[model samples]
Target chain A: EDKVVQSPLSLVVHEGDTVTLNCSYEVTNFRSLLWYKQEKKAPTFLFMLTSSGIEKKSGRLSSILDKKELFSILNITATQTGDSAIYLCAVELFDNNAGNMLTFGGGTRLMVKP
Target chain B: DAGVTQSPTHLIKTRGQHVTLRCSPISGHKSVSWYQQVLGQGPQFIFQYYEKEERGRGNFPDRFSARQFPNYSSELNVNALLLGDSALYLCASSFGAAGVYNSPLHFGNGTRLTVT
Candidate 1:
């Protein structure tokens, strides 16, 4: 079955500590990988990585995908209390008859203590 | 502009019952997708509708069904609801059915369904 697995299911770090979240996937019809941050409500989009080696970054959050390795990593630097949330990784794949869809990992819940 | 909107933010139902959740996508977005997110897990795709057509569906059973209106708004209905059906039902909108390639989905806060 097509699936994505994320490591360090949960973590607690004091402010200013850097953390890295990992995700590995196995699926057919690979297209892209996306990262999201979920706080209390719905998830908000973070980064979408298509090609390998090229890193996508925004402020203190950055991500890169290694297609050959079938994995992706999300890094958060100089973390603040606001950074606490569930970091989710999702793989987008083309479905022959169903167009495209996303298979998501279990997510990494990070708590940034201030 | 307002983000995706879902109605009946919180719902309570019992086993074997039926319930319907509603969603209004962002203006101009033509595609809407549904997801089921249980506690401590990521959201799982349930269905995708565009132009009132079913474009994709996940591993959910027939008990789960959804339809999109001409305005691009959608509704999700669950029949013979089981306890396992309790979850946060999320609605996301994008420009088209193929947006999974590039478009980032704008998600609504979601409806919390409690099955007892």
Candidate 2:
């Protein structure tokens, strides 16, 4: 079965700390991996990594995909209290030539305290 | 431009009852998808519709159904609601359902459903 797993289900860190979240997937026809940040209600898009070894960065948040290992990692530097949210990793599966469907990991919750 | 919009920001339904959730896709978007996010878990895909056609469905049961209108709006219906059915229903829309490069979905705040 196609699935995505994220480790360190929950983490707590002081402000300005750097944290790494991992996501590994076993799916057929892996297309792209996306990361989302959820505060309370809906999730907001962060980064979509399509290629391996290439890092996509946006401010203090960045992510990279390792296709060979069927995994990805999201890194947050200089973490602030605003960064305390659920970080989700999902893998896009293009099955049966159908359109893109994302299978998401259980998400890692980060709490950054000042 | 308005992002995806879903009706009844909050809802409460009893068990064995049926409920319908509405969603209007972002302007000019052709694809709409539904996801269910239970407490403390990731959002799970329920259905994806494009151009008023059913493009894909998740592992959800037949009791869960959805449809898209010609105007690119969509609705998700759940029958025989169970306590387990309580979750935040999210609606997302994208301009196209083609390749990875073209399909970037924007999500709405979602409707919170509480089953009694």
Candidate 3:
């Protein structure tokens, strides 16, 4: 079975603080890793990482994947109150018979205080 | 353009009852997927449909069935619901087939089902 695990299930940080979330996966035929932020009901897309070493960034948020190590990390340079949400990590896998599917981690709940 | 849209933001059911959830994919999107998310847990993949064909399915039981229409809309039906079936059901859509690289899914707000 494909599995994705996230570390530090929950975190509390203040404004301007930087935080890093970790995700590791064990699967066959790795296709890509994606990050999302859920505030209320829907989860918004953040980044999709496919290659190792190269980091994908958007404003204060950034992520990097290490295929060899089977892990990825999402970094928030300066957090704000609005940044409080559940951070989700999902791994996409492709199988010749099963086609493609995504498996998600439990997610890390982040509470950013103003 | 509207994103993925699901019907009945909330629902209440009892054991042995049947429920049908509806989803309309984004305009021009050809792929739609369904997921179930329990409180405090990650969403679990239930089914994926593209071009009106079943592409992939998770480990859910036969009681959980789904079908896609020619317009790319989809419906998920669960029969004989149990207490454990209560969860948030999410619908996601993508422009291309799920296997396509770099394709990200756009999710709907989700339907919260509470089985009493």
Angstrom error of the Cα, residue A113, model 3: value is 0.7
Candidate 3 segments exceeding 4 Å error: A96-98
In angstroms, give how far residue B108 of model 2 lies from its true place. Answer: 1.0
| Candidates 1 and 2 compared by TM-score, better number | 1
Tell me, what's the RMSD of every candidate? 1.1, 1.5, 1.0
In the range A1-114, model 1's lDDT, one tens digit per residue, is 889999999999999999999999999989889998999988999998999999989999999999999999999999999999999998888776556788889999999898
Tens digit per residue, CA lDDT, model 2, B1-116 = 78888998999999999999999988999999999999988988888898999888888999999999989999999999999999999998988872267477678999999999
Query: Considering TM-score, where higher is better, how would the candidates rank from best to worst?
Result: 3, 1, 2
Per-residue error at A108 for model 2, in Å?
0.3
Q: What is the Cα-based lDDT of residue B45 in candidate 2?
A: 86
| Pairs that collide, model 2 | none
What TM-score is obtained for chain B in each of the predicted models?
0.96, 0.96, 0.97
What are the clashing pairs of model 3?
Answer: none
DockQ of 2: 0.57
Interface RMSD for each predicted structure: 1.7, 2.4, 1.6
